[model samples]
Target: MYKIIIVDDEPIVREGIRNRISWADHGFECVGVSENGQEALGMIAHFRPDVVMTDIYMPFMDGLELSRHVAEHYPGTKMIILTGYDDFEYAQQAVKLQVTDFILKPITSAELREVLDKLKVQMDEERGHLEHLNRLKQQLNESLPLLKERFLERMATMALNEWEIRSKMAYFQIPLSGPLFVTIATDMDEWPSEDQGTDNELYSFAVYNIIQEIMDKEPDSAVFRYKGNKVITILSGSGEEEIYTLAQERAEEIRASIKRYLSVTVSVGIGTICRELKDIRHSCRASVAALEYRLLIGSDQVVSISDLENRRSKPLYDGAESENSLISAIKTGSPEDVDRSIGRIISELQNASISIEQCYVRVLRTMLAVLQALLEIGCNETELFGKETRLLTELYSFRSLEEIEFWLKDMCGKAMIGVAETRRNISRNQISEAVQFIHHNYDDIELSVKMVSSRIFMSASYFSSLFKAHTGKTFVEYVTGYRMEKAKELLKHSSLKTYEIATKTGYQDAQYFSVLFKKCTGDTPTEYRQKMMVDGA
Candidate 1:
């Protein structure tokens, strides 16, 4: 029920109005009656009624003045004007004050009920509007980051002509004439899911605050939300050197501040400044590419295109150099030749003034080139990458020449190992049947290669060779690795003791299980569990 207050100088008028209408029947409670507007205003503060009925002419402060104050201070409170005088001027003034209802002398019950009913409807409509607005806000909050990501992704890959690029830039409020640079940031490590709590909101807000603070330190600088954890900038009225210095200094500061304040790792990649909007895509690509060298430079490092030297006309290995050469070296199986190849690539890059930190990046790219070549030859090894292309697909994002070189080399080594092992194990039935055996009897403590082979209709000696050929793993090694992996999971997620965990992973002897766990993970099950708990995982 809505609360109501009545105001009038005459006691008779107040009593008559109070008693004449049954307020309860009209969805209101006449909580109090006051002599003048001043008394009513005092009651307004304390009672905080939803509706007020007041006389026009009262001693001290008048109703018109009081209505204006109510409109300002308590706009949600509905007002009904009460006046005995039949004056058009008073009615006009009341309307101007936004009085909800105007009832002149001898207040009728019908008019009073009508005003109360109107207020109820208005309140309901206001509530509905509020709820609708809240839902829209939630949707916008959830999708804004993703929408911005898609926008930037399209900008990076699509090749728009000069006129079209400028038109688009103008439409998006991007300054087209001056030096432009892009910097993309990414969250490096995963945070604990449960421990994050409400920290994600604060984390995002802090990232925005840092970007704003950095931009504020520069002249004629603009920052835009590029994507999640990324802020892009366009600095006008500055030379390329000035832009580069500002980005490097600010990125270093941001990295340090994040470590100090948020305790998370972030890497910033700065692109070269370009005057043309058509070249902004190159700047964006360069910024993204800089991130690939993070493994060598360390997390939170800022890398630029200028730091990497240009690539040579031909690959270190010429077009005539076959995969067999690389494979024969691996199968001779000397780690020394692979190491020497990697060393020469590094030395050449360094002599050309390329950064050593870009080595991993070169490795990644070479792997992709190798994968592409293998694909052309109809070689399928999708399962080697956990049956996903995301890891390989990201190679195209290398920014610097050094980054590209390092990624290529890394990719080459990984692919060589992944492909060689995969090719060695290519029998379908043997692998399929072995997988079935492992799945069905994974809980058996006495499960072994001998027991599995006997059940699957294969001799023990033949099964060992066939399993290795088909799965790139001997029977004993495969089962042990699988069991240890399961044990790791149980130790991390469950409250089970080491003995119980050993049993769960098919080990009857807890001591033997502990020894194996230590060998696989460099920590006992208890030690691993303790570390996970400390990390709040």
Candidate 2:
């Protein structure tokens, strides 16, 4: 309802205006009546009426002055001026003050009714507009949760390009930008069994609410379900340290709350800070990767990639480069070469000047890599790494790295046997066997690429790639290198002539062997042997 205040010097006039019209019919309430503008000003402040009607000639403050004040301060307050004869000039100023509508002296009920009807219509439109804005705000609030989940869930699972990220960000009205996104993967420790009989949805939502209550207090963050029993929270802030601090603080709060109230343990895996939203999948993976350390670090702990990285005295070598060969070697190489290959990796770690702690970390990494490769080849983790498997417990119990190293070396040998039993992850194992064949037959003068590929049952084209993957060299390059090493061994330790050495190392034509040997080792067989003799002397 539109509220109205009547201001007049005459009491009768104020009552007459208040009672003359049916205010209810006109969608108005006569909230107050006053004898002068001063009293009416006080009423206007208190009631905040939408419309005001006042006589021009009042004590203390005239209606023209009141209209001027209301027009200046409360511009939205509509005013209809009251004037009598000889007050034509005051009416003129009222027009300049932009009063709503004015009536002359001896105001009639019909004329006042006409003004009230128009004011009622104006208030109706304004209130309806306000209601519309409110409805839109409510709808937006309802849809915000769905939009957040869609974007967060997608980011967690897949990689999005820059344009797609920007467009979705704009569409969802997320005010945050790139250069500082941190993903934290939070999981409940022993929760699946703890809450098995409870309402899953209610239980999850309760946990979610606790998550939001903890994470949303950060500068900018979004919390959503990452998967069953896990929720992902991505936070955006200024610097890497600041982001880490925020995520760490929030994670502590959540952990404490869950422990104190919920009686269950929740652990967090915080990733590295991403420089762009499009690359945030890396952060998500890192956070999840941090979770992989929960078992080593202990459950219900908050771990960061930096925390794990700091545990090691040096950076980890890209074991991925040698992993395929390691797996391949494990599958087909002799027990000695298999041990040597795993030793080579550990040797690399050992020579890097790492601390004893780093030795433990690298040993664990080596074992996990072997296990993951086994799993990739189609073996169940439980069969190999399940609770019943004593390898992990024994691994943790080792006192010295040499003992641990020896154990891991033997484990790799056993794992190769276990992996080869399944035949689950092959295609690359064929290349390993092809490599094995090449190593054994490099001394055969008739050995060729086609012959090796045929023996392995893999096409030459496929074998080429897998060989490069496993050996980091083409098949011909590996064969030649092996032959050159053997040729060098003969030159140093045997009295064999150059031509005899060439034929022994699988070269039928001595001249071609000389050229190939010179190309690979920068020396002909004779020159290499002479240099070896002099060095030996």
Candidate 3:
């Protein structure tokens, strides 16, 4: 209720005015009556009244003085001046104090009712205005996070000019202006298939918050959801080694936090520290590439461009020798040998730490080489590489290293069986024995035309000529191809090192093995493995 106080020098006048009106009808309550303005001051403070009525001609602290004091201190407390005189001077002074109303006393209930009704309307209007402002303030607070996230995303990706960037930065209150930047990309290591209905948005939001909590400690950093399961973090600073170390440390913390709190593990890929925002895309690609490499590295792994910087040029298996062996095995109708050959390629590929795309190229080359050699051996291309898109169309689409490896072995073994059934015999006894002997003892670096000729009790020169004539290749060519085939088998099927593959393939020097393999197969051992292990899902 709007509480009111009535004050006058005459007790009768105060009581008469207080009782003249039904105060409740005007949404008011007269809680006190005062004989003078001095007394009303104490009563007004105690009651905290909304409106006060006091005589202008009181003995001490009259109506005018009370209104002036209340207007200055409790300005919200409006007051009315009640007086017997029609004093123009008092009216002017009441205007100065901004009194609610100047009244000629012997106050009536009807005039008081009109004034109280207007004051109620004023109060309600003010409350509505305050409520609208509070609602706007609430909405702005809620939208702030969404705005900041979008702004950070745009700054990381959009090609905004300096003026535009600065203007928006100022408007959105972003403090980032990157001359250097580091980025981290994350992917959930494993999400259960049954949890497809899990709150992805909630999880992403929680993950983003965790990342920011770790990263923002270093300042000039932000986190955003770049993909469904991927949260990307960008940190701005000098492109220094310390900056990288800091980012890496934060990445480790982020990984641990998510695992501990979210009940899931995430693999993190740290990008190259770009020198400027304009080159940020390079860092983004580098981070994503690092994440993709984690498919080979495994779950909960953190890969950085810096970690792979020294590794990018390392020796990958050149699948040439492996390729030759596979083709030779396919052409020789030895499904066992062909299986060994494919296994050798897969094993060699597994030994290297190259990207999936690089592995894909190697596997594609080997697959094509096998097809090529099969074609050379009179195998039908359509029969071998069937109309089924699963082989060629979906070759790159295969997911795991094992899947591609198994697929290759299955296809090659099938082709090898075809070669065996259709192969026309050339010098049935002698050539067959030589080929078998070569396959069994190709690892002997001393196995040569002389040794083989001696085993057969034939003259060296005659045997060499006859062997070339029957096989359509020189004796040395046949032996090198056989040894290379053996080397490929060991490389693909076993965990043998390159030097071991070399010695087993009959080369005294591992470098010589690489050289020979390159000459014959058009790729180094490491290059071959890098191309074949293939790729990720």
lDDT of 2 by residue, 452-515 (tens): 9889887888778777887799988899999999888988899988889899999998899899
lDDT of 1 at 211: 69
* lDDT, each prediction: 0.69, 0.78, 0.77
Error of 2 at 58 (Å): 0.7
On residues 1-537, what C-alpha lDDT tens digit does candidate 3 reach at each position? 788888888978887878888888878899999888788878877889988878898887888888888998898887788888998998999999998788886767787778778877886677689899999999888787777667666766666666766676678776555677888888786554555777666777788778878876765776777745678887777658777887788888888899999998888999988775656657777887787665455568788877876775546878789899888887777778878888888877777877777888888899788777767766676775576635556666454566677888888877876676445343345666876787788888898888887776678898787788778999889988877777666655677788988987777899989999888778888766555555311
Question: Cα lDDT of model 3 overall?
Answer: 0.77
Q: What is the lDDT for 114 in model 1?
A: 79
Candidate 3 segments exceeding 4 Å error: 1-151, 175-179, 189-191, 194-209, 216-218, 259-265, 295-299, 324-343, 352-357, 370-537
Q: How accurate locally is residue 318 in candidate 1, as Cα lDDT from 0 to 100?
A: 30
Instruction: Please provide, for model 1 over 1-537, each residue's C-alpha lDDT reduced to its tens digit, 9 standing for 90 to 100.
Output: 789999999999898888888888777899999999988888999999988989999999999988999999999888988898899999999999999888888767777677778877886787689899999998888775555445445565577787765565555545435655545444433343656575665676676677668667765555555546565655544576766776777778867777677777677777767776566677776776666556444556666655643534323433123333444444444556655555555444444433433443454544545566556544565754446566535554443444544554555566567556554444465568778889767779888888888876779888788888778988778888888888888988899999999989888899999999999889999999999899985
Better of 1 and 2 by TM-score: 1
Cα RMSD for candidates in order:
18.1, 27.2, 29.2
- Evaluated against the true structure, the overall lDDT of model 1 is 0.69
